[model samples]
Target: MQTQKSFEATTQGILYLVPTPIGNLEDMTFRAIRLLKEADRIAAEDTRNTQKLLNHFEIQTSQISFHEHNSKERTPFLVEKLLSGETIAQVSDAGMPSISDPGVDLVKAAIEAGITVVPLPGANAALPALIASGISPQPFYFHGFLPRKKKDLNAELETLNKRQETIIFYESPHRLKALLDQIEKVMGPERKIVLARELTKRYEEFIRGTISEVSEWAQNEQIRGEFCVILEGNANPVSENETAEWQNWTIKEHVEQVMDTEEMSSKQAIKEVSQRRSQPKRDIYAAYHEI
Candidate 1:
């Protein structure tokens, strides 16, 4: 266990995690700008994108590319520079580094090497979207980007389907409609969902409605910019105690209960039961048919 006395003066070079504006350039903080200029070098997710921000702010800081493709190769080098007392600042193309972008490995390496990591709060898409979403912001889960593959995405949604805390996810414009459709299918059509896009920019917009309604909207809108989805938590959800009761029922009996309540066919009932019990559908099917 490591305790970070962040403000304490250390002889070792510090690693500053600086956040850039998600949209508006004015959102860049003074401290972030200072750190970028003061650091020996900047490690950016995309050097070209970060260079534009640097150009706009008139902060002429040299940047080295350190994204997912090269993080493994570059982290050790950055850590060595830090250990040698050369301060480095890391930034993503937008928002905070190591968030959905890159820099986590470097930060971890820096910490292990006794290098101080000082994070400067600046701009992010999630917090603004959350505050404006009219959903419960206090106990929200930041799931970031979901899996790209449909099957993996579905499996993830299954785990998150019953969470009581408001959930936020980032999605690209091209995939937004597909993702909303998937959410509607997995989480149900009537669940409340808000899509905040182009956050903090002039074209910033919010699409708020039930999952089905938003899914419809997603299909029609000329989708542009990144998307932040703020979804309401499950209401009147099945509790663990309620699900534990299913443990007492035989597999066939459990299928019968779900079939009667949801008016689903034997096949459909088995699928739902499989998800709830975290069991393979084939296993549930075999046990049910065995009875």
Candidate 2:
């Protein structure tokens, strides 16, 4: 139940979310530079890293460290400063603040405190990678990073495999091979994906192909830099056999088939049967076991 008139005057100071360059420095916008220069203080994910950017542009504004570990602690302090009429700019190491970064919590707190929060768009890796990815750009899903654990990663992929929009994920250099392997295993080999790394830098590279091909290539390649994976989404999600599966099945017949085919216990089979038919497992179990 809140309305934000961004340009309206307020007693509280403003919070400007400034986006820094992902790699190349020239991508820094004039407004971004001016905001950073004029802001009373800059809240940076890594002050040491952000200092280099400030030094390069000759903008001498001081920065306070605000990262994942410290954001919760720093948020209250920053909010108080805003209430005291001190304008602040929040930035990440690269790209936009709050996009897979810790600045999100601060922005939420700022809004709740009735501070005017403004976002200045600048360079980000996903859009740059997406447009060049040759995949469908509209209706895209930005999943910042996939799960690191194997079981969770597989479960996530199961849901992602059914999405109809282009999918995006950020992966570190070391995890690229494992991520691709999971993609090939869960999403299938034919799904188109693009891997972009070192974007906007001298060695910026794009790897585009089927998941299997890219996975194979990544296996032996000398991997470096963070990667942005753009995957083509599902269009033909319903398998012909799956479409016909629900039509010919009695409750008991479905449960028996899943138990026999999947080699599962009655309880496990009941769950699968329920998911496929969109029925409650408790109800399916009652019918199958006649209880």
- Model 2 scores a TM of 0.83
Q: What are the per-residue Cα lDDT tens digits for candidate 1 across 1-291? A: 888999998888999999999889999988898888898999998889889999987888788999999999999998888888888999998998888988889888888887899999989999999999988797999999999999999999977888889999999999998898888777766667999999999999998987778989878888999999999877535677987898899889999999998899999888767656655567889998994
Instruction: Choose the strongest candidate by TM-score.
Output: 2
**Lowest summed lDDT over 10 consecutive residues: which window, candidate 2?**
272-281
Best by lDDT: 2
Backbone clash tally for model 1?
0
Question: Which residue segments of model 2 deviate by more than 4 Å?
Answer: 239-291
Candidate 2, 1-291: lDDT as tens digits = 999999999888999999999999999999999999999999999999999999999999989999999888999999999999999999999998988887999999999998999999899999999999999999999999889899999999888877889999999999899998888777666668999999999999999997778989998899999999999987645455775975688889888887898798998878666655545456888999899
Model 1, CA-based lDDT: 0.87
